[model samples]
Target: MPSGGDRHARDLIWGRKSDALRDLNRRRVLRAIMVSPGTQVNLAKFTNLSQATVSGIVQELQRENLVVVDGNDNERGKKVSLSNVRGVAIGVEVSYDTVTVAARRVDGDVDRVVVDWSGRGAEHGSQAWMRECVQLIGEVVRRTGLDETDIVAIGLGIPAAVDPRTSTISQVAWALDWERGMDPGARLQEHFPGVPVIMDNEANFAAYGEYLYGAGRGTETMLFVKSSTSVSAGLIIRGLIYRGRHGLASEIGHLVMDPLGVVCQCGNRGCLETAVGGARLVEQVRGAYVGYRVDLPNSLANIVERAKSGDLLCRRVLQDAGRNIGIALSRTCNLLNPEKVFIGGELGRAVELVIEPAIQTMRLHSLGGMFNYVAPMTVEASELGLKAGAQGALAYALTVHHIRPN
Candidate 1:
């Protein structure tokens, strides 16, 4: 027969082990709801748990105020959603010519505002630009019917590499004029007191946003490239952003293509960006039509519009840029072997003109053995499009809001 102390010790250890398993099951149920709200039946299917087990876990979560049951008490009809999530989240993306702010309840639809700052002195490091961001965020909050006090977190996405250790933008991020150690997140926090702010590279957030809610959904691994005024890439491995040490992992735009070609802002020659960035494409078109054409595109958007309207020069330039971007992406694909590739930003809007050529070029450069070993990778335009960065920021804020300690 066991002694009293031995029995007590056995009971305590078993009880704790049981509690840990239950906690893990509860987290699985909660995550399924966060991905997309569904009835208990649907959650059971999504999580691969028995229906009875899912129901019990859902009930426990509801009692703890972690989930809300929408609709009637009917088990088949009621939908489960996250409840009492504390507060809403805001995502802001700042570009050279635009600022986009999106606000949403932690478990609801998003409301957004896009403000064009082209030629209006909205340059980075300018106080006016920061003020404009604050104003637009206020407008988005109003649209969402949420007060500033209800903002729990704000996510800022910039077109620059952020040092994870120091939280500073890199000097080579020429698109931004922000000084070292200048925290954009901190600046936004001043407007919404008590709310914490998170920041990351714009492409990184865009990739995360797409992974969670757009084309990259259901993919185990994916790479997202943004080819707009500049070129950048982001990697999503198993639904999480893979920011390498120092957050410089996916600086594909700076990858050198030619040692003696055009000089890049990063002090490199013939970087991928120099060959395929929107400005360079525009330059090529402008120079080609210098004396021949009466109508010239003033911007990359204009060129895309012209290409859609059957301008051969515009079409060729976009195709050429696509090919170059594809060649660069091929090397990355060989290394990471992503299941899907998503293209976003301005040029991504012209899928018919750009994506096909990109796919062709990538196939040409990729390893034949790799292609034979796995399923042929799919390439698609980003479903979030220009809103990817802002939406990603919002999703990131909501995801981290509950985990951060006060």
Candidate 2:
């Protein structure tokens, strides 16, 4: 119905649209590869693009030096990953007595270090811990063979509630002893310029880390509970951290278990923290052995060690703490319907002494129907251990856009 000129015009328009779509698909392929190394088949599934589309885009990206392919050229044989032209990302986790720093390219092993600063209090030590943290991060990056200028993104995980919108600490996290709304990332930025910083609660990052690279891998929904000096939980729903409004979504430690129980740092009484926090467990053990032949536990870590060495009192305390944790988690399981629960923190190292009680308690309180379903709720120890938060921070940094070197 149209002349050659009209047909030519239509052909040009269609060709341009097709080219744009192809470019978009190329980006999708690159993004998938950046997240993790995989074969073309995996990339197609991750990007929801055709194998042919991924193959074509991957070849183009390879030509442009934007991607690196591993192994042979067979479609399912070779693994494809990003070339890290944008530099590496760093993850920092600052606990009450320890700081861990990790650095890595987008898809490889990370260089990490853990430093104990127990006696050097952050608040009382004139914020010297911040300087130490910066130094440790630099050291880790150096181990990765990358200079300071190569840092593109930094993700920080602090032991406190962080306001996502403001990127500052929340008032409820009084244990930090810093200003209620102080931005730790902004403070760290002074040491590393031109790098975008992302921050979140340490437990949240740990949960994400467990989801991405640890015990919660492949789970549709997962919950991670940190039972240390303080009690906290992180929820992952559909592969993403579910930070509710105010960034205080999973503060299960503050759940009022007994209005008449001990007062928490948040000024709340009888919270789950009072019953199962690491400090509380240690205190119970010390009080019980004050005038006995058994030695007193100076810290929760010590108590866990004693439990593993056949200390009946220590084992009972850890088991009791686990049951209490399970009681709190049962309530969480009822509401969130998480598929798996991961136990982390200093106490999680005790494993059976703690987790067994928790699993039993969860069964006692959680809905029976959900457990009867095809996949009953599962409980496991954190695969990343103390490094979970730091690793999660690194993974988080990879997901964000950072300043590129010009």
Candidate 3:
């Protein structure tokens, strides 16, 4: 009973809705493929699409050359992957003393580069780190035989909390003096104009990386603790990084451990960082050798190496740090009850020295249900190690729909 004009308007609105829904489904399929290639059945499960819908989408994508289907078996059994010709995703991790870059192709190939900037005096600040980041990105991209124009999206991970609303650095700990409120994504965007930039905390990206491809894979809930010049934690819930309000969800370092302990950078007293952070552990070892004629270990890595080589003082300090970290993690576990916890960063290199004590302490303080024989929670070393952050950044960049293949 509608008039001709009314009918045309209704039809247009329905057409738009249909188109939008189709595009969204296409994006979901593409994202699942980016995570890892699989058959139509697996893709259907991953994307939560009906098998018929997945088949139709796969056929459409194949015709457009966006994805390739292989195997001489039935259509449902063939593996589907993103075309190797698709543009690359770039991920960069900027820590206090290091800059790591990774370039990942749509076909699952990756090239990476890492540089140590500790010797570059602190006076240079953000400028020096940004410059090094640019160079490292360029180097890694070239290693993949790709140019700047071939970059689809970039993920920048910094050792500071990034405000999710503004995509800018919100809070910096004492270890990194990066300017507060600076938009690292915008700065990186200037270098690679037209490429979208995704910025987040390095720990968040590291957690995502481990969840996708390392120790935390197959877990619905996981925690990644990054212990370096500073201490921070990232939580992965259902395959997504849980960045809570203002993007400071898992800031375990600021957790109060002592009421009247040394003041912390965030103006807190007796934070977990004060007790177990890399700087504090290094300080403890150096304090032990003070006024002695013998040379002392200077950096956390040095302390770790000394500990591995039978330095009782270094071992004891790290063990204490591990115990304190366990205490903090116990509280966290009691709340979130993650399936797994992965320890990464510089301290992770000495897993044998730290993980056992941490586990012992955590078992003591955490709820007994967490240690039940069946499906017990476990803590392990990060399989991806220092590369987790950068690789995670790369994987995350690919997940964002910055650009569609032409």
The TM-score that candidate 2 achieves is 0.85
Q: Which digits, one per residue and each the tens of the lDDT, describe model 2 over residues 1-406?
A: 1111111111111123334677657655654554567889978876778888888888887886666788867766689865535355677877766677777654453323332223342433327777787877777766665567666567888877888767778754466567778777888888887676788898999998888778787788999988787788789987678887778989999999899989988888999998988778878888888878565788888989988999999999999898988889889889988888899988779889999988889888999866788978888889888778888887776554332231
Deviation in Å, model 3, residue 269 alpha carbon: 0.9
The residue pairs found clashing in candidate 1 are none
The 10 consecutive residues of candidate 2 with the worst lDDT sum are: 1-10
lDDT of 1 by residue, 1-406 (tens): 1111111111111123334677657656764665457888877876778889999988887896767788876885689876655345678877666677776654553323332232322254557667878888777766655556566567888777777665567543555577656666676677766565778888899898888778887788999998887888889986678888878888889888888899997777999999988778889999999998888788888999999999999999999988888888889888988899999998889997899998888889998654566577888899989888888877676454132122
Local distance difference test, per candidate?
0.74, 0.74, 0.78
- Badly placed stretches (over 4 Å) of model 1 are 1-57, 64-66, 70-79, 83-86, 109-125, 293-295, 369-374, 401-406
Give per-residue CA lDDT, model 3, range 192-217, as digits (tens): 76676888999999999898768787
Write the number of the candidate with greater lDDT, choosing between 2 and 3: 3
For this target, which candidate reaches the highest TM-score against the unseen true structure? Answer: 3
